[model samples]
Target: MAASYELKASARDRVGKGAARTLRREGLLPAVIYGDKKPALPITIPLKETTITLHKGGFLTHIGVIDVDGKKHQVIAKDFQLHPVRDDIIHVDFLRVSKGATLTIEIPVHFLNEEDCPGIKKGGVLNIVRHTVEMTVPADNIPESLEIDLAKAQPGDSLHISAVNLPEGCQPTITDRDFTIATIAAPAGMKETDEDETEEEAEGEAE
Candidate 1:
């Protein structure tokens, strides 16, 4: 699970391109909090603090308690706009989420025990098909990443999404079929050698 955070923001009295530009000039970023069957609220936050949070990473995946004019809203950063040349966050959109709401997010996949895997130890290459898996999870129980154990994985073994152990209340969005996540394949040199041996065998049979 990701750690929670609190962001301080001031309610915006005016909302428009002009007002947003003025706030940016004053070193503030314009933001909006909407959803949960409530009216959208326009707000502004400190540019410095927002920049630091963005640099820390996982702002979109983690839930944050946003304080706007003494009122708190549990939300997640859904979308953000950045200045093309300056690479600054100009505007952001926050989606209010209830505790029991189910949300879809792409969680990163972390492979473990690669050193102990017989395939990897025997010069096999690990080919990753999906670096991240999209899943539907409760708002408050989002996982940081999914771990896949490769302790017994061997060469020519393909790992599918069904092999992963997900946390309770977390389900993959892709439920139609068991998609492959990774594979332990033979190295290019090994593949070439096998092809050469097959060709030699075929020539010997033909002769």
Candidate 2:
């Protein structure tokens, strides 16, 4: 089951850059909630609670219950603005969701079976091309991470995005048939090639 977080929000009467900055100074983060046939509502949330919830992996993809003035609303973190220098969250955006709605989100990729991988045993290096992929899935069935097992992969072998085993009701947003997620390469041979190139360059300069 997907993880859930409960948050508290308050209606905001002030909007714009100055108001947002003022709220942040008071240890609050400005935010907005929209969707599900409702108009966008501006709100402010406690910075401490927002930071704690966001620290959880995949928190943005999980369902959130925002308590506003004693009323609860189901929403998901849709966007966030962060401080440029410190990278602290400055603002947030939430999207209201229904029970059966399908939402698209980017999920982290987890590489598994590395210890038993044939390529690594043969002194090959695994190159990860993508760390995440976008998927459209039922809100209730969002996966925390997509696992790709590389036990049987040999040097020069690659796993494409299509090869990933997704859970039921979850599908990748990318339709490209040849999108590679990871590849195993001959590390020793690549090093030898680099050495050879350096030697050739020296010889050319000597001539």
Candidate 3:
């Protein structure tokens, strides 16, 4: 699960493009918290702190408590606007997390035991179909990343979502069918060699 964090912010009375620009000049970024049947609260946080946290990865999935004056809001980052040139976060939107709320997020995928894979040891290429899987999970038990074991994977094997063992209370949003995750494909040269061999065998029979 992604780690939780606390950010200090001051409620901002002013809004609009001009007001946001002014806050940027003052080394603060404008952000808002909305949802869960509550009013949206606009606030400004230190630019340095926000930038550092965002670069740490999984910022959107990570829940945070934003302290505005004496009030704190438990929220998850929903969206953020970045400066086209500078890549600076100009504005951010956070959604309030109500009790028993489930979140939809794209969790990263990783492969384990690659060296032990029979396919990879035979010079087969690992072709990844999905680097991440979208899932709706309970906020309390969000998984960091999904791992697939390739220990017994053979060439031309298609690893599907059904192969992944998900955590309790976590479900993949894609439920219509068993989706493919990755495949161990035969090498390009090997494929060509097989084709050539097949042609040669056909010619031998014709002779």
lDDT of 1 by residue, 1-207 (tens): 233778899999998889989998999889999999999999999888988898888887899888998998888888889999999899989999886798888889999998899989878989999999999989978888888899999878899988999999999998999999999998777788989999999999999
- Write model 3 residue lDDT over 32-82, tens digit each, in one string: 999888889899988888998899987877888888897878888989999
What are the lDDT figures for the candidates, one per model?
Answer: 0.89, 0.88, 0.89
On a 0 to 100 scale, what is the lDDT of residue 110 in model 3? 91
lDDT of 1: 0.89
User: Ten residues in a row with the worst lDDT in model 3?
Assistant: 1-10
Worst 10 contiguous positions by lDDT, candidate 1: 1-10
- Which lDDT value does model 3 have at 204? 100
Q: Could you arrange the candidates by lDDT from highest to lowest?
A: 3, 1, 2
lDDT score at residue 79, model 1, on the 0-100 scale: 87
Q: Deviation in angstroms for 194 in model 3? A: 3.8
| Better model by lDDT: candidate 1 vs candidate 2 | 1
Error of 3 at 96 (Å): 0.8
Residue range 1-207, candidate 2, lDDT tens digits: 233888888999999999998999999999999998889999999999999988876677888888998888888898888899999999989998888899998888999999999999988989999998888989888888899999899888888986788889998887757688989987887669878999999999999
**Winner by lDDT between candidate 3 and candidate 2:** 3
Question: After superposing candidate 3, which stretches have Cα over 4 Å from the reference?
Answer: 1-3, 196-207
Q: What TM-score, over all chains together, does every model reach? A: 0.84, 0.86, 0.86
Measured by TM-score, how close is model 1 to the native structure?
A: 0.84
